[model samples]
Target: MSDQLQNLDLPYFAIFLTFFLAVLSSLLVLAPTQRGISATWDYLKQVKFIERNGIVVSTYIVIAVSLWVVVMIVAPQFFMVELSFHDGTVAADVNYDYSQTPYTFNNYSYVIFGSGSDDSYFNVLHLKVFLRTIIASVCITLLAFVLCYPIAYYMAQTAKGGTVRLLLICLVLPFWVNEILRAFAFRILFGSSGVINSVLIGSGIMDEPFDFIKADIAMYAGLSYAYILLMIFPIYNAIESLDHNQIEAARDLGSSWSRIHYRVVMPYAKPGIASGCTMVFMLTAGALAAPQILGGPSSLWFTQIITNWFNLGDWTRGSAYAFLFLLSCIVFVLTVMKYFKVNLGELAK
Candidate 1:
């Protein structure tokens, strides 16, 4: 048995086995409850709980607090931090070492303030990437919302099942193909000397093919295509749940189409807009592949900073970048929540 266990290849097998055994032992201890012997004791315990809902809730709180204590006190010290060396000479291997660690803010200072002769703590390239990420995310979200809003409204207002189903199928059909393949297909279409240019030039629209690759226009177009469905589905569901009677009542009171939409429909669709914007923002901010392939060397985004850090074996700096990105996202979310006057609980509803 020991030899067999030693030969086991599964990394988490021991942990799973321990949990299984603990559960099995618990079941065994509770087995007497299945018989009449422990029935009276169980009933007594249940009756004692009637006067102590507060006590039950308090017990849960205490257990949760204890679990957190264990995690905070025991986990961090035991877990080792892995480091990698990649000087571009040999195969980089992870090493666990903290022997010469200093009890100061040296690492943070070095990352933030830079080393001698470098003269800067933060990388300017990274700053550029971060700004580009924000710009790209905002552009994608706005473009997607503009393109999807009308389609979603139409889908919601339409009553015919066949038409709605067909529209939905058309909306989602692109997803049937793999995302990378779709991106590459866009790349092909929008590349210099591609179909659009060929047709335009052949029709005497221009003398030369337009340079579509690595342009901001191409990046926005590609990202908008990728994320339009995300924006559409949420807004469609939100608008579908709206009461049509309200719109009819507004119309009866002589409200114009624009007035009805602005006053009645827009407020209800806020939650969906919030959700879709959040999704698009996060996805586009962290996007690496699309920018790399379509936008090429000219376009830089924050995720590329993460990639550079990882490739250079700078885990601490990479973690810092991730946390900074998270902080920015949280701030944006909070701002939106405040502006909309909607809490997370309301949005969830």
Candidate 2:
């Protein structure tokens, strides 16, 4: 086979060809009457083995435990250790030594405390950026949930298919535009000479144009707009799958609207809410573009710090920060899974 075909990794194709030939050969070897006898004999042999179940059960348990150990514990630690060894290296000619030394906790210490050298190290500003990112992510996730839940619930309960379809289309329409273009559009709208200010000034709504770009309000609005659809779809799917009869039954039993929602609808929709929150939190936490454009100079987010470290040839600190963010995402996902009592693996499907 050509290199290009080999690179396609057609192992499954090869397996299918082999299996087809084996089946054809088996059919040729066995006469039509003997096929039934062979099948019955094979079944009897398998049933006889099943009668001796202890060894089979023990072997299955051992295989499952071994797979779990490799997947859950050993694999991640192995990769983290491998990445740590080659974390930081300078490409261009510089006075700094780029020695591949033995692995040590120096990278962790530098990430926690300022290194006070050419090597990029964690600082108070970095910490502030990290904290601000957490705060921003939490705010965005909460606000998205608040806004999305009502719309999702309305769409789920209402029978107006045309209106629901229109709303869903409109919600997803912004995503068709390029993300950077959308961010720039927001930037223009919130900029000093943008349309919002011009209209407000023209209408005498305020004396001066609001400084939205330098403020947190602009960041919140932009990020929320970016991730709103992600928050909506999961909740919508969740609520759609719910049994509306149970909800009507609750109301028939003299339950108030609030009681019906809290008691009947919310529990069923917990999986969707958890899934949506996980997505929104993770996306907002790692947001780079919206903050960079809308936040101006004052609101430097965690991603910008990573960018700076990368620019300064400080891969170690950058990797450390990246890993930390990854850990946070994992923890947040696990927490959501725990709260909803849903297996993340199953929900992800």
Candidate 3:
């Protein structure tokens, strides 16, 4: 840890170099050796297809794809996975890069098993938070759907041109402010001496102020509001495409309002419902700002654990936590898709 020590990154550099060389060698072996270089050489000859699009367009596409793959997605995640497998230590604590430390499952084991004993507080607390997050996210999605459906229907179907434009402006106005600022606004509204309390107390509605944040109501409300737009637009787009004549014909057949919506509107909106619910659920589960700003002490989301690990200089544990969270969200998405009987192509629409 002392300044007198030589470069501590040397060991880590050596390990990285080894990994790079191994991958490069494998790629080289996979390249063709026949006709000039081999099948790989023949593959390079396939560049003619790209050239058909014109050199400029081909060059731009290649650069964009390469950047997306290497910089935006693969490289960072690849290193994070590598970090997750290694037991990371502070560089200041040793003479070497600590790269000599054997790779481990300790980070993942800590998460799956617990921070301490099998039934420790951390183990129980984290599990509880994870479950609560999933349940709360689903609840938020349902709430948003219920609240937005009527408004979306009116806007997309019944509203005239001016009314539609006005409603859209209303929706966009609230989001012009920063998301964190909106969260803080919710915090103020729910605080003990804040707007709700002032009105309730003035009206003699209760004997004392209610702690909405402590009760976690603020978190639920904030999350639902935060992702409301995601739910609205998808359903709007789906319903907008439906023929009004079908609804009129159903009404002519003496189908009640409930039956009309149940049999007609909902079937047409299935893809939108699936898409919106999945997006809301994922966003709500991964939410940090709303929970941090508005949730009570009891409302511990999984992202908080990831942040704590990083602040404690434990990148391995943090990466493991992040990866696991991603896997859980992916599973939830697949479940939503299955329940709606919609494939990826349908959902995209």
Candidate 4:
């Protein structure tokens, strides 16, 4: 089965896949729903103005959106998904001809079970890394919500115009620095002989430099800081859109602060919370830089493993790993949507 797919045509496959996706999307968009076909028709009708934008302008806008969806979003993922089912070794042998690669699930098998060898029959290490990545990502999402919610609420509800502007400046200023530079700054702060340890030892707080990096403290801190803004803004927007009179009514009815938030604020903010959580979880799970720079010697991120496979010219296996990660993220998003009862339309709003 080494060259089983050698006769396959690449262009034909791409065209077929694109056609299939178009049909699928059409069905989804045209389905009978309150906000599906009807909403689309409304949008189209609204496009026709009294001082009309020309048909050419509208055509250009549609073309631009289509190109962005197909070229930027769909094509890369389609190629990756296609690559995941093939054999990289055979492709490499045939001068990187993907058409010559036979299809196999050996890559996914390797993810589930070790090379069919006697000594290591289970891929325990990689599985553990996958689980660790998921768990850490969830923790980070929760932590970001806990930390940012109050600030978002303060900015959206309590703070005056100038105070809100000052808070926004403080939040946005740090992120203006490049992410890599920020990661490096974290490394310097948490490194063995870095500032924290230097201060501790110099001031007689501790005799030896504590290993914050080894404890994975820097990784958590860095990842949290990196995605903090993403978690905050969605929540702020949601809360800001809420009617302040509702909160006042709750208070007038003798509701405590905690009860008011739990009953009134939280239910209204579900869409924002769900959106923030999904983004943070996915970003943290797939993170490379913070894991690379702030992670300890003993630490390993799932993305680093996928990157290694690609770096070693095993694009097939890398694609499989990446696709699997993507599937996991999709599942997480669906679960969150289900739990929060926040659909795509609400999140979009």
Candidate 5:
């Protein structure tokens, strides 16, 4: 096998060593942790706590959880992580024959430092686009939160039965259309010669049309609108179960509306706020269609970079980019949880 290996770049020995190291690391890190968790779960089962709490705690449930973790999270991410560590150009065959080549961290290095011109701990171009995506996504989350919170509050606390149902229908109606179609609709509406521009021209408000897409205002608006429901429903669900009498008591005690929300409502809705923000931020960060359709020429989303890498037949690079993007999202989620002081366990509720 070594004689058949004619490559030095992605050496077979390196691959074997890397694979060995990865397996060793996994065992070293995961063995005790997994053992502890398994022991704890077993203890819980022995005590009948899980079953007493309405959980089945059955073999089928255990199998399902194992299968979900292995299939949904472990297997895919393991392959991607492996791919991200490989040097595709060196020993990779036409079909990514990595037999002769070992995995390398060059893919990550390339994306992070960009050929080492200025190895100042950052790849300027990639970092710029990444930060732009993060900032824009954060802005979209905040805008959606601000825009939907009041509406959700009204629907949950103030609206009559008929009005609440009607508002919910209105909220969900737009989602009946596909997300891609909605993005395209925004494209036409924000185009230079589209509805808004035509209206301005016809009304004599302006002789010229404004280019929303070119200015990237359309991108921002589209992203906010794209994930607006994600921001609304979580908040609505959280607020709906609140005791209305507390609000009434606050009102009777001369608490203003803003005060009522700030002191009472928002504190109760932290979990929903965290959940909504996490969803909106992640969706906007990973959005492809809305940015592709409504973003300006200069507006570059980081996901597009990953897409381009895959299109260019570079799965290793694409996987590296994806992992980095995923890391950023995880970091953002953690930051949100920390800031809002919401437990991950609470997000599901």
Candidate 6:
């Protein structure tokens, strides 16, 4: 076997193998691609607006959407996942040859298990940070929901025109400033000698300033506040579409506020609640500015580790971490949908 292998034309064999795989892949994808194209064309032809908008305008719209999906979304992700398979050490080298470099799953392995030098098998430190980030994000999502639901209910069902306008202005006012600036404002307000502490001391309500920043309270508050509008608007939209007569009927039946919301209001607002929760959770998980500015000294967010890897030129590991984070977020969204019994089409609404 060794003698025969040594006698073979290795380069020619490699070329033949590559060509064979390419042909096989193309054959596999060709049928599905053709079917998708045919379906899209049929749908476009049946669309009502095509007659008014004309073929040229419709063609331009399709082109724009395709370009946006391919260029802005798909291409970057494809490159990222491609880069993740390479050895981080080799990928970081300035003079490295891409084709000659070997691929390895060490980046992902390190994410799951400890470095080879470690006595323990699991990557406890990184896993702990990842779990903490997920839990904190969930808490922030729930906090936003709790704070926004009442305001949303009022805006949808009870508030008069002038009152609604006033509430909207108040809600939208703080968001006019940059997010980092808002985080900084929270930092100031929650600082030891900041407004809250000062007021408490001035009124003789407390003896010494509390360390809200060190306790991680500021980070939580900032995260909750940052995405409050996202939580509010969706619930309000869902509740607004709900008929007022149902709430009136519930009240006429002597239903308590809690019972009304639990049985009637909430079931109708499932899609909106699910959408808002998904948005808030994803945003909170990905947030860097608020956590960096307001987080306690001991706090750690998972994105910070990913940023560190990229900043240090370990693109392979960074991409792996990023793809992992993206996958986790996608799983979370799917879980939320399953739990709420809502589908993607309903959530989109």
lDDT of 1 at 109: 40
Give me the runs in candidate 1 sitting further than 4 Å from their true place: 1-122
- Misplaced by over 4 Å in model 2 are 1-81, 85-101, 116-122, 336-342
lDDT for every model?
Answer: 0.65, 0.70, 0.78, 0.82, 0.82, 0.82
lDDT of 5 by residue, 11-72 (tens): 64476456545544543333323345678688767888656756555666667967876787
Where does candidate 4 have its weakest 10-residue lDDT segment?
26-35
Q: How many clashes show up in model 6?
A: 0
The runs of at least 3 residues in candidate 6 whose Cα sits more than 4 Å from the true structure, single-residue gaps closed, are 1-38, 91-100
Model 2: per-residue Cα lDDT over 211-270, one tens digit each: 988766778888988888888888888889888898889989999999988888877887
Better TM-score candidate (1, 6): 6
| Per-prediction TM-score | 0.69, 0.70, 0.81, 0.86, 0.84, 0.87
- Candidate 6: the clashing residue pairs are none
Which is the better candidate, 1 or 5, if ranked by lDDT?
5
Worst 10 residues of 5 by lDDT: 26-35
Give the alpha carbon lDDT tens digit for every residue of 1-349 in model 3: 3541343455754664565454344323322332334554366458574657887887887689668757866577666656765676534243324344556667777776675755554667767777888888888889999998888888878999899999999998999889999999999998999999999999999889999999999989999999889989999999999999998999999999899989999999888888788788888888999999998987788888888888877777888788677667777777767777886666668
After aligning candidate 4 to the native by TM-score, how far in Å is the CA of 7 from where it should be? 2.6
Question: What C-alpha lDDT does candidate 1 achieve relative to the native structure?
Answer: 0.65
Question: Residue-pair clashes per candidate, as listed?
Answer: 3, 0, 7, 0, 2, 0
Question: Model 1, range 233-271, lDDT digits (tens) per residue?
Answer: 888989999988988999999999999888998788988
lDDT for position 157 in model 5? 90
Over 4 Å off, model 4: 1-53, 91-95, 118-120, 199-205
